[model samples]
Target: MKKLLCIVLCLALASSLLFACASPAATETTDAAATEATASEAAATEEPAATADEPVTITILRPGDEEKVKSFLEPAVQQFEAENPNITVEIMYESWAGWIQTYPTYFEADTQPDVIFWWDNKLYDSSAHDHLVNLSNYLSEDFFSQIPQGIWDLVDTGDMDGVYYVPNSVDTFVMYYNKDVFTAAGLDPNTPPTTWDELLTDVQTIYDVTGTPGIGIPAITGSEVLEEFVGLFLNQATDASVLDSSSMPLFNTADGLSALTMVQNLSKYAQTSPTEYGRGELRALLRDGQVGIIFDGPWAVPTFKAAYGDDLDNSPIGIATVPLAANGKKIDWAGTNGWIATRESTAAASAKLIEFLMSPEILLSHHIIYGSAPLYASEFDNAAFQYDYWKVFYDEAQNYKLYGMIGRNSATPAAYYTALEEVWQQLVLGQISAEDAQAAAAAAAEGVTARNN
Candidate 1:
């Protein structure tokens, strides 16, 4: 009986040991399963990190000749795409005239391009002004530092708090002369006019000697060219803006009267039917040697180059700074065009593309292709800018108090131009005295101010 009881005890002890060992193995397996399940659940709930190769697409447009813009932009777009891989860029081409008419519609529909080539003076008056993403938030200080402070001030309308435009093109006016016309007039080609009196004398001499209009005045009745042409004289005479920041008529002052009188005196030698011609017509006349002088911007370079080739700066064309007023302040009428990113969703990529476009190498090429004055100080060193013609433009950009369009901040920015055109035409045609013209212009400006401000 004792041997049987001992055997039972031994069996119970073995069973207990087996049970303890099996329990531990089962717990270990359960723990391993729980860890695996927890990891799977975690992966299911959490998102994977985004890779650099994520797809994105953005569209861009510049209002200009489609062929010319595409010629330079298509290759740049290809390079940009290759470098980015994840981003696709599409260029929406529109002509200047057509875009001017259609842009308001695009802005109203929220269908404007992701990135746009825009006018600085007109931005405050456009629908896109409110839609533009503040570029200051995306562009770095280093990028802003590359441009001059004067340029930034030129584009500021005082209507906005942040930088919305990235000015790539800065343009100022200079007087372009035909050397042949100067020689025919018995005036030295190398010695162009230096003052308002000299300019008038030279125009008269050229008209008397050559029997051709000495200067082409672009006073097309509904166009802005006349306003710009007269505004330069006003800026030079008054040493002030044509319209104050409040869009009031600054051109109705005594200095403004003197400027108008100067324009009237000079008009004696200008082309017949001045109201029929625009700046483009005048430039064409200058290029053909039919007009002795025209005040134009750097955009005239390419046209003259195509016509004259290597002799552009030599015997045929003579470029000089716009003649000084009696006050001798070096002031000029200037304008700017730049890039603006409109869509908030694509602002990041749009800024990236703008940065790429504004890079020194790319910007230089753009300036060359667009025939614009160099915006960067570093660009002056480029071989393309080494010419004497470019030097005149560069110096003017450096020295002048560059003023923008009149009524730039007005609700109807074109009103200033329209208001002055008829009265200016009358002044040039001798239908009204300069004093009367001044009053008419003032009344028109007051009407615009009342309606717009």
Candidate 2:
């Protein structure tokens, strides 16, 4: 998630609860609410109800190292399994912290997963690069083509060698702020900033008048955080790649330097750079009114809604597309989540299942259940997608440039981002000239490239 925005389109399950007859998952204790999947032993003991012809065991694996898999996802699987007797899903959860080691060992073994969970763009690339089965074999062209044009764009990521992935739901980055804080600072809550310049000015104003941070800037999400939006800004101004693997040191262009300088300079106005604190901590600052703005994905909407309520509409919340670079249109850096066949898959069967998953009705249910945006027009039939809060993402989706998790561990990606962070810190700390920091960062990047290469 730190490598790119993972919050947009992630999910599972359907509930049959109708009207007042429903027993929400919340009826359980807090621990059970966290993750209620029955263990293999527990399942054996219960003789649980299942679909007519459930598989002996339908294994599902996902890597997040996040607690949400158990808390939020397990219940969905349980409910689905209850209705589908032949398809009892056995979820194997693992965290991202040790995933680099655990994943290969688990997936490569005889027990490969039938369905998997992943952060859309990053996981797709890693799986594709590793020669995971091409997902195209699992779904039809008509089906893929029919996915809302914008959501489908996420899977392409402009690589085009092959359609290695398909994003099932839609998602993007937006500026989330506390309207009450804005009001206290005498800024207009109804008008969130649209340009990078306005954002800067707003931050300084908030800090000056309210003694609260103007914003929370995160370098931890990696360069893609700024690179995706800024790439559009600068390239529209003058053509450039954030990192050019075509050359030795990746991206060290004048434009690249300028992007870093601009972002780093803003650190002086930010409450804290994200690398110094976990992302949840930063969001908490926004909720508690310590910070006025944070660049986050659609997931923050529900979180703030639950935590603040009327505060969200009155004193508390607002969501808008990420601020635009002067020359670029407002855009989001979105990712995808979908099914992929394994190395020895049966193409026909895989294709059928993929088709089932892509159905519009299923897509709508999935997104609604997870608080995600749907990737197909079929979902818009549900009243939820019509909201203004959701429209911001829909608008951003049209202009988004989906990002892969390439920079997480790779030299070009890491160095380029690290350079941006160090440059920002230096400029904020008044330790080096902007030009000097860019040059030095580029030099250091060259060394990282040579060594990694």
| C-alpha lDDT of all candidate models, in order | 0.85, 0.58
lDDT of 2: 0.58
How do the residues 1-453 of candidate 1 rate in per-residue lDDT, one tens digit apiece? 999999999999999999998999999999999999999999989644333356768899977887889887998899899999888999999999998899889999988898988887776765767788776777878999888777787886576778788988888999999988899889999999989989999999999999889999988877888888888999999888888888788878899999999999889999999988988888889888899999989888888888877346674889999999998888888988999988776777888889889988888988987889887778879877877778777777766888887766765787778877888889988899999999998888888889774
Worst 10 contiguous positions by lDDT, candidate 1: 46-55
- Residues 99-141, model 2: lDDT tens digits: 6456556565645565555444343233333534455644567
The TM-scores, one per candidate, come to: 0.85, 0.70
Cα RMSD (Å) between model 2 and the true structure?
22.4
TM-score of 2: 0.70
Model 1 error, position 428 (Å): 1.4
- After superposition, which runs of candidate 1 have C-alpha atoms over 4 Å from their true positions? 1-55
Model 1, CA-based lDDT: 0.85
